[model samples]
Target: MGPLQIKNILQTSPENQSVTVKGWVRTKRESKNAIFIALNDGSTIHNIQAVAEPGQFSAELLSTVTTGSCLKITGQLVESQGSGQAVEVKIDDILVYGTADPESFPLQPKKHSLEFLREIAHLRPRTNTFSAILRIRHALAFAVHQYFNDGGFFYLHTPVITASDAEGAGEMFRVTTLDLNKLPRTEEGAINFKEDFFGREANLTVSGQLEGELGAMALSKIYTFGPTFRAENSNTTRHLAEFWMIEPEMAFFELEDNMNLAEDFVKKVITYALIHCKDDLNFLQNRLAEEDKNKPQNERSIPLLEKLSFVVDNPFERLTYTEAIEILLKSKPHKEKKFQYPVGWGIDLSSEHERYLVEKHFKKPVILTNYPKEIKSFYMKLDEDGKTVRAMDVLFPGIGEIIGGSQREEDYDKLLGRVKEVGIDPENLWWYLETRKFGTAPHSGFGLGFERLVLFVTGMSNIRDVIPFPRYPKSAEF
Candidate 1:
């Protein structure tokens, strides 16, 4: 028979059939007459118990089968007499594939701080917490593709390196092969980028929206799920130097259509996770509850499952940025002078402001639209009054802005003017602008940070914790 995953084996009814299970030992308890070993193979959050009689195996083998040790146990499946599980394997033979020294193994079947687990990231996946998180992460990623594919949206691969700055944020990681010690200088005493690998200048892409839009202009609907880099030296729980982005662009889609699609898309994916990753979600929910126990009542968050269900069940509260600002202005926190930053029109909304709107006022997901042009990207379509743009930010209860997007400027002259107004070199974006000149129909797209979504779903407080290998300021350790 094929190797059975622990998940399937655990689900199998006890028919007294012979089976072989291979996995790492989570914990082992030995008595005078019996030994119980909890084994997991990264298949599920739960572990399968394997029982062996004393002297059934060599003392050396039993000693080696400690915590974190790899083992293959062939046995008879029987109805479990244990309290926690339904099925247990009555082992007839045991093989030790690898052994982890009990003393050296950082994970010793105890509660570990998230901070400590991050230090040993290579082995963190073996922990119940990280394994559950990774399983849920995979479910969400799969749901992303399945959702788009079922809706006729093609998966488009965007470039990692590009000549243009998509966000124009000026926080790009420079890509060059020029010798740093021996420099190439131009006549103007500037570093000559012409001698670099790309011949002019290039850097890692910040977003795939620009290229995804190009695909949408032709393919009707396209989505890009890939890594994007930012050179900003931010050392916060929310910021990462390298992260994955999910950007979907559509042709002939106005701001309203974009909003509808985004709301539906997120709800669908979250729903998928709820259905496919029920066990992992339950584990994370319990984990979050335990973590919140030490915090003040006001500081504690809503239960993970409840928060997710609320998002999926309710229609998001939609309002303009102006309306949201009006609400914040009249809020108790604002009136009591509790806001950390000043709030008014034409100002960028901070996380506090967003949280207030979603967690306090609406108590649900909030979609704020029509942001002032000055605070948003240049490519966003301008409004008739020549001030606000048709931008939208989807705010979750815990996550400030889960998704940000806008109706792109289809007018060539207007787009060109805004491009120059923002100090972006028009010549550098000629190709993107040329789309507006030729066949650009009204298109709208949004970018969702993959790690942020995982953070929300897994109930992970730190962005670094959700991603396996987090890249941040001053740290890129494996």
Candidate 2:
């Protein structure tokens, strides 16, 4: 028979029943007449204790059972006499699969700093903190698919390599096969991209919204969940060179319907995690509490579980961007000269302003809509006022701008004019322009940074800690 996972063994009434288990050894201690070992298999944060009698196995075999060692044990599951655990295994035989030397291993039995663990990304998953985080991450991802499926949304796979930039930021990683040693050039002394792999300039996609719109035009409702790349050289806690995005587009939907869907979707996913990941969340809650003890009293945050419950139960505040700008102008921060960026009518809102609105003024998530057209993407639906577009940004308490989306312009002439106004050639986006020409409906969608959701749900301060392997400006090791 196959070996049972430690999680199932602990929950089952397998007392006096022989079972085989395989996992890595987390810790080992020698008693007067027995050897006690804590075994973990990444199934749960809790470890199952395994007790071996003296002389049950050879001394040489037992000596190699240090921290991080892999082993297979055949034993009878019995009630544990220990204080924390409910059940344990009484080992009858053991086989060492691999041994980890105590003197050379980086992960010891003590608590390690998150910054230190990041250097060894490959081995960090074996730690308790990382293990719990990864489990919660998986649960959140499952909830994403479940929520969308229940809402009758089709999953669409968008292309990773494309000839157009959806955001129009021009910050994209180039994909080329041309050799720099011997490059082809035009008569104008410019590099000839026609000789490249795609016969023109191609890049890793910055956003999948454009392709998702094409699918939505036919399928009515579709979503894309995949990796995206950016070439920005930002080395902050919030920036990553590569990340996952969740973008959902729907045909025949307006700006109000888009905002309603975004709110419902976020609440559903968070509620799912609260019910399914109680233990892991509790561990993280306590960990954050301990860390908060050293900080100033005013800077400490509320309990993690309570904060999550508040978001799930309450309704998000909604207002126009112009109203938000007015509030910021009269606020204490602006009067006291605290804001680094000036607050005005047409300027783009910075992170500090976003956090202040959600964390200080409203004290909840806020959806600000109708941003100035010059500050937003060209494809956003133009407002009747001719100065603003139907753009909305969802701001969470700790994390600012968790989602950004807008209603797409359906008028071909207006969209083409906006495209030209943004300095992009209309000929280059012939396909997207054609969608509006033939049969375009009033569609809208938003892009949610998957990592930011994980970061907010797990109560993690840094974005890197939530992802398994983080890619940043100068670091891509492992």
Candidate 3:
């Protein structure tokens, strides 16, 4: 058989069986008679101990087996005499595949600051914290597809380059092949997009929701999980220039259906992580506890595992935006002017407002619906009062708005009017408008930032840490 992964080796019974394990050396200790090497293959958070007699290997070879060195070790598996671990390997043969110079290697079995890790993102995955986080991230991603597949939702691939601005926010990365040095110009002296690659202005899509809605119209249920881009220059903990999104659109679903689906989806995935990624989650929970110890008692976050359990066990509180506003107005923080931004009916709710509802007031996940039309996207179904739209936002404790979605307006005239009001040319979105004109159905969908979900589950403070390579303002290093 091929070399077994460390994860499996650590779980097997010691029958004095000979096995070969290949992994990087995490730590090495030398003593008078024996050498102990802690090795990890990134199969799991735990490392396997490999014990070697002083004369088992050449002195030069043993000296090169420092931290971060790659090795292929053949040994007899036996019950460990160590206090913490259950099993260990008694090395019979060893080969050095590669060596990391301990004098210059960055990770040396020491605690590292998150900011410093960001600089060495390419190497951070070798660390325990990142390896555990990456494992949980994989679990969560698998759970997302599995849940949708079990629910009969078709996975649709949408175009990354689109002309239509889904959010109408004008914050998009322009896609062009035209030479900037000598750009073609129209008679009006404007940079002519007519000579561009797609024969018009094109950009990286801000969402797949619009295309997802098209699939849902015919397929009944559809979902999209892919990269989306934004050109916003904001440098904050919550912002990323490029990130992954999970969008699920369903036909014949109203506002209540949308809210219910979002809640169940979130709870199901978090539960999956709890069950499948127990070891990784336990590591993260401990890490979060250490982080919380430094903050003031009142400012510290709830324990990671407990917070996740709370979300899964309890039903999310559902309330309308108007009702949410009234509650906020009566809140002690509002009266004391503790919020950085003022809260009112027409204004869009900020992260501070969302956390107040989830962390302080409701003390659970919250689904706030029926936001004012001005603050929501144009496709949301406008209420009969013509003031609000059927929009919903899912709020979590540490992270604010984890999901945003709405029931779409099936009325073509209203959608067209809103498109005009939002300053988008009707001709640009003619195909989208045609859908509303032809076979329109009551549909709803929501967007979940994939990194944000990982951040919450991993108990990570910065959104940058959860994702493998973070893309942000003026920084695109791999």
Stretches off by above 4 angstroms in model 3 are none
- What would the per-residue lDDT of candidate 2 be over residues 106-215, giving only the tens digit for each residue? 99899899999889999999988899899988998899899889888999999999999999999999999999899899999999999999999999999999999999
Query: Worst lDDT window (10 residues) for model 1?
Result: 54-63
Query: Measured by TM-score, how close is model 1 to the native structure?
Result: 0.99
lDDT tens digits by residue: candidate 1, 357-452: 988898889999999999999999999989999999999988899999999999999999999999999999988999998976999999999999
Candidate 2 segments exceeding 4 Å error: none
Can you give the lDDT of residue 151 in candidate 2? 88
Error of 1 at 390 (Å): 0.5
RMSD of each: 1.0, 1.3, 1.0
Measured with C-alpha atoms, the lDDT of residue 107 in candidate 1 is: 92
lDDT of each prediction vs. the true structure?
0.94, 0.92, 0.94
Give stretches of model 1 more than 4 Å off.
none
